[model samples]
Target: MKATVERATLMKSLGHVQSVVERRNTIPILSNVLIETSENGEIKLTATDLDLQIVESFAANNVETAGSITVPAHTLFDIVRKLPDGSEVQLNAADGRMAVNAGRARFSLQTLPRDDFPKIAEGDLPTSFEMPSSTLMEIIEKTRFAISSDETRYYLNGIFMHVSDDAEPTLKAAATDGHRLARYTLARPAGAEGMPDVIIPKKCVTEIHKLLGEAGDNMVRVDLSASKIRFTFAASVLTSKLIDGTFPDYNRVIPTGNDKLLTINPKAFFQGVDRVATIATERTRAVKMALEQDKITLSVTSPENGTAAEEVSGTYSNDEFEIGFNANYLKDILNEIESDTVELHLADASAPTLIREHDKSPSLYVLMPMRV
Candidate 1:
């Protein structure tokens, strides 16, 4: 394959495709990106790790011949990244090697047969929808932080997304790690209703987020099946196999009747929590929240270290209550809440607290209390 492409265009597309390629792989081809030049003057880059695949194509000029080859994704990305700005990059594949040249910098990389690249066969995407990039990004941001890292309970390791077909159709994204859970809802897209819910794996969520974040003002086309999901837009496609486990019923855990409300400036509250958590131990990074009248004291005690506490001003008038929670978990929810004011609904000292935007949001957070 021989193609001359603009440095900036190739660099951007390589950056996207390379992220999907795993750094360490037992299979040789999985570590390389599939580069193919078409007769129409478009060069396509594809990378996959069997479970996830991404294909991105960009326009190129001065194509002498049409062919396909696979080269190290990261190495190629690094070459393009370091190339002089606005320079033309030439790529040629011959004799089992790929030559990359830009300006005076020249490099040759080993190539794997393009036929070795794996492809995900998504039979028929019965469910399809179109969502704004901003909305999809919000959904991922609000819930991805709570994805479980514990592999034993694999079901809790990804975001659960589904279209709620009720009186008001809505799209819901939820995630939990047993200690904390995040739920975000948005208006349902036209073609997503009645589709089977899918548990999108954590890595898939990460890659999808990276792409959408870079995509400014672009719309995403979502296609879903029982076992796989695909996001296609802007000359690129990201497809991943669904996690093979059932997500727990998230609604059952969302606390109800937690009436005691405490409203505080999220920025201030988050800052105080972060500051106090510095003195906390890794094993038990617990923070005690002592709420009474209109003030809350966030305190952390470590036997090896000393005690650190901060008094955060809040709006609470009910009976005094003290609750213990994992400091990191508390901060996780606080950071996801975008509202200026954060509302914490408490039942008592030992119940799950609901953290949400003060002005009723479709998104809500549930944090289980821990003994201080």
Candidate 2:
């Protein structure tokens, strides 16, 4: 294979696919990316780690001969990345090595046979829809932070996505890591009426987020099946396996009787939580909050680090009470609320609390209180 692609174009496409290639792999081929010249005169780059895969295609003006080859992903990415931006890149594959030439620099990378590269199964995608890329990005950014990190509770290790119909149809993304839960929703697109509920793994959500960040258009197409999901936009396609577990009924965890109300500035709340958490112990990251009369106080005490307290002005008209929460959880939830004011719907000190943005963008958060 011989082709001359602009350095910037080649590097950008490589950057898009390389994230799916893991640095450490049991199989040598898994560490490499598959590159081939398509029949339509486009360069196709593919990378996968069994569960998730990404394919990106772009055009090159000069073509010598069309061929396919596999080479180390990171190594190729770095080589192209360091090359002068406007320089022309010449790629040629002969014998068992792929040669890259640009300006005065040259690189020879060992190539593996492309036949050994595993292809992800498309299966049968019965549900498909397209939505604004910005809308889809908002749903993921607002909810994915709560995805569980613990492998034991594998079900909660991804975003739970589905379509819900009440008075109006809505598409929602939800995630929880036990201490807190986040749910974000948008108006359901026209063709997503019967989409199946699926748990999309954390890694896939992450890669999709990155792709959306760089997408140049307003829309992204999503195709869903029982076991897999595919996202397509521009010349890139990402396919991933659904997490093999059922997401819990998250609606039941949202408290309805949490009537006590407290309104606070989110920026202030996030700063207060962060400042107080400094004195908190590593084991507990705990912070105590007290509501009295007209002022809200945040306090942290650690056996080894003494104690710290700060007061932040807020509006609370409920009975005076105290609540304990993981300082990190409080900060994270507050950070996600991108509004001037946030409201906390509370039942009591021991019950789960609901945090809502004053604008109420159909996103909600539930934070389970901890004993300080």
Candidate 3:
């Protein structure tokens, strides 16, 4: 393929597509990006890692002839990025090698056959809908921290997205690591009817976040099939294979009748945990929470490192209660809360605790207490 493209445009598109290509590959073609020029002179770039795939299209200035070729993703990206921002770049494939030229610099890269690149099949997507980019971002940011890193329970390695009706036809996203669970809901998209529950893999969640962050538009189109899901933005499409196992029913883990309520300044609580956790050991980073009539104290002690304690002013009228939780879990929930204060509902030390922002919204967080 031969084409002349703007340096800045090519660099930006390559930066996005190249991230999908793995630095080390079992298959040589997987390390290269497929570049094809259309009749109208637009350039299309595609990259895949067998599990995730991305295709991006952009306008190019001139086309010598319509052709396709595969070239090393990282090499092409570096060559374009080093060129002057507005300089015009020319790329041509001849005699099994690709050549890139801009101004006074030129580089030749080994090329792979485009036919060797794997293609992700576009399955029959039964449910298709459009959701605001901001809404999708909120769902991911709130629940992604709780996704399990444990590969044993492979089902819990990704965010569980499904339709719910406790209040309305809401889009609920839930994640759990057996110790903590985070669940958040957003208003269902306008035409998102009859959507099935799907577990989007953790890698897909992260890639979608990057794509949405760069997308300046308002909404994104989502298409879901039985085994795969595709997210389409203005000029890019991300296709990912869904996890195969069944996700655990998360509702049972959420405590239903937690009576004790403690309202505390989120900033104060987070700061206290941060300070007390300093004394905690690397292996056991546990912080103890002692709640009384109108005061709360956070303490952490390690056999080798001694103890650290901090008192944070809070509004608590319930009976005396003490619980221990992983300091990292507390920090994750507090970081996601936007309100000034957070409400903690507890039943006992052994039961799960419920957390929510000051506003009476549908979102809630449940954390399993750790043994102190």
Candidate 4:
């Protein structure tokens, strides 16, 4: 394969592909990226770890020959990243080695046969839809933080995506780690009416977010089956296997009878919780919230670290009550709130608390209380 590509363009595409290649691989070919050239003036790079795969293509004005080869993904990415800006990179593969040259820098890397690279066979994808890249990104951002890292409950390690028609036909994305849950809803896209519920693994969700960074003003095409999902956006394609477990019925955990409401500036409330959390125990990291009419006080007491408290004024007229919650979890939920004001609906200090934007936006959060 002999092809010339711009340094910046090559570096960007390499960055996206290399991220899918694992640093430690039992199979030799899995650590390398497959590079292919075509007569249509395009260079394609593909990387995979068996479970997930990413392919990206970029225009190459100069293609002396069309061929395919595999080389160390990280090494190639490093070489392109350090190359001089605006310089063209020349790649030539032959005799089981690949030569890379740019200006005064020269490097040779061992190449593997492209036939050794594994490909995931995408069966008939009965469900397909197109949605704006911005909307898909928003869905991932709002719920990914709550995805569980616990391997025991393998089912909770991803965001659950499905279509809901209970109120208005909407697409919902939800994630939870048992202590906190986040759910975001948006109008269902045109081709998503009969889509099956799927759990998108955490790593795949992360890669999708990164790929969408360059997808300015573009729409993302999503195709899926019961076992796999694929996303296509802006000269790139990502395919991932779905997690093989059923997500719990999240609606049961979302409280419906919480009537007490407290509205406060999210920024101020987040700052207060952060300050008081400094004195919390390292094991629990608990913060105590005491709410009353027009005022709320956040306090933390640790035997080893002493005590800290901060008073934040808000619009709450309910009876005074104290609730305990994980300080980090509270701060994480607050950071995602884009609105100036946030509402927290409470039912005493023992039940799960419902939180959302003051305007009742489509996003909703449920945080379970802990003992301080």
Candidate 5:
């Protein structure tokens, strides 16, 4: 393989593909990226961790020979990344070594046979749809914070996406860690009808979000089956295996009878919770919120740390009530809210609370209370 690619373009593409390669690998070829020159004289880079794969193609300045090679992903990325900006990078592969050349630096990495690189099986992605990149970004960003990290409940480790036609046709994305849940819905896009319910792994969700940030106003193409999902936008394509487990019936936990209304400024509430949480114990990170006539008192007491209390003005007309919540969990949900005011509907101190931007907004959050 022989090609000359602009340093900046190659580096940017490398950064995206190499992120899928893990730091440690049990299989030698898994640590390498496949580089190939296409018939039309474009350069393609591919990296995979068996479960997920990303392929990026870009136009290069020159292509002398058409061939393929596999080289260490991180090493190649680091070498290209260190090259001076606006420089031209020349790549040559022969004698089982791939050589990189720039202004005054040279790197030769041992290559693995291109045939040894494994590709994740993509068997007939029957369902395909297109949506604006910005819409996809919003759906991911609003709910990803609640993804579970516990390995025991493997099904909850990612965001659940499905089409809901209950009240209206919409695509809903939801995530929960058993302590808090976040759900966001948007009008279903065309061609998304009859799409299978799928759980997108957290890693794929993160990488797709990064890709969308650069996509601007472009549209993204999504193709998926019950077992795998693929995203294509710009010159990049990402394929990931879906989490093979059943997601719990999330609608059952979303309460519909919470009547006590508490309206507070989200920014003020976030700040108050953060301040009082400073003295909260590390184990629980619990903070008590006492709601009265027109004010809310945030308090925290730790055995090792001192106590803290702050009062924030709010609008509540119901009887006084107190509830305990994990400070970190509360702040995470609040960060996703973009409105000036947030409404919290409470059934009781022990029942799950419903939080939203307003009664009409499509986004909803449920946070379970903790004992302080």
Candidate 6:
């Protein structure tokens, strides 16, 4: 293929596609990116690792000849990233190598037959809908932090997306790692009825977030089948295979009927937790929270390290309660909450604590207490 494209545009597209391609692959072609030129003077870039695939198309200048080839993803991306941002990049294929020239620099990269690249079959996606990019971003940011990194419970390694009937048919995203659970709900989009529950893998969630993040004021088209899901945004399309196992029923884990409520300044609580956590044990990293009439004290005591206690004034009129939780988990929830105040409902030290934003938010966090 022979084409002239802007260096910045080419680098940006390569950065997205190469991230999906694995550094080491048993199949050589999987490590390369497929570049093809169309009759309409548009260039298509594609990369895949069998389970996930990304395809993007962009308009390029002057196509001398129509052809297709595969080049090493890392090498090509490195070459483009080092070149001047707005310089005109020219690429031509000769024999089994691809030549790239921009400004005064020239490089030749080995190419593979584009036919060897795997293509994810486009099936008839019966369930298709569109959602505002911002809505999807909110769900991802709120729940992705709680996704389990434990490979054994592969089902919990991704976010669970389903339709909920609580009040209305709201779209719910939940993630859990046995210790903490995060759930967020959004108003269901029009024509999103009959969508099945799907567990999108963690990698797919991250990739889709990057793809839709810059899509300002645009809606993303989502298509889901039995085993795969596809996201189409702007000029790119990403398809990923869904996790096979079933996600645990997260509703049972969320605690209800927690009576004691403590409202605290979100910023102060987060900073207190951050400071006291320094003295916590390396393994548990537990921070104790003691709640009294209108005062809350955060303390962390370690056998090796000294104890630390910080008092934060709060709005509480309930009975005295004390609880211990992982400092990291508490910080994660606070970071996701976009409100000035945070409400923590407690039943007892042993039971799960429910956390909510002071404002109206269709989301809640459940954190399992630890033995201090």
Better of 1 and 3 by TM-score: 1
- Give lDDT tens digits, candidate 6, residues 1-372: 799999988998998899999899999999999999877899999999988999988988878888999999999999999998689999999799999999999999999998888998867777888988988888899999999999999999999998877777888899999999999988887766888889999999999888876778788999997688999999889999989889999899788798899998888899989999987878759999999999999999888888999999899999887889999999999888777788998899999999989536877899999988
For residues 1-372, what per-residue lDDT tens digits would candidate 4 score against the true structure?
899999999999999999999999999999999999998999999999999999999999699999999999999999999999999999999999999999999999999999999998989888999999999999999999999999999999999999999768999999999999999989998888899999999999999999887899799999999999999988999999999999999999999999899999999999999999987777759899999899999999888888898999899988888999999999999999999899999997789999999545989999999887
Minimum summed lDDT over a 10-residue window in model 1 is located at 354-363
| Of candidates 4 and 2, the better by TM-score | 4
Instruction: Report every candidate's CA lDDT.
Output: 0.91, 0.91, 0.90, 0.94, 0.93, 0.90
The residue-by-residue lDDT of candidate 1 on 35-98, one tens digit each, is 9999899888899999999999889977888999999999999989999999999999999999
Q: Which ten residues in a row have the lowest lDDT in candidate 2?
A: 355-364
User: What residue pairs clash in candidate 2, if any at all?
Assistant: none
The count of backbone overlaps in candidate 5 is 0
Per lDDT, the best of the predicted structures is 4
TM-score, candidate 2, is 0.97
- Candidate 3 global lDDT: 0.90
lDDT (10s digit) by residue, model 3, range 55-99: 999999999878999999988898888898789999989999988
**Model 2 bad stretches (over 4 Å):** none
User: After superposing candidate 6, which stretches have Cα over 4 Å from the reference?
Assistant: none
Residue 293 lDDT (model 4): 90
Candidate 4: where is the Cα deviation over 4 Å? Answer: none
The superposed Cα distance between candidate 4 and the true structure at residue 340, in angstroms, equals 1.5
Q: Write one digit per residue (lDDT tens) for candidate 5, span 1-372.
A: 899999999999999988999999999999999999966889999999999999999998999998999999999999988889999999999999998999888888899999999999999998899999988998998999999999999999999999989787998999999989999988888888899999999999989988998899999999999999999998999999999999999999899999899999999999999999987777759999999999899999888888999999999999988999999999998998899999999988899999999978888999999887
Candidate 1, backbone clash total:
0
Q: On a 0 to 100 scale, what is the lDDT of residue 64 in model 6?
A: 85
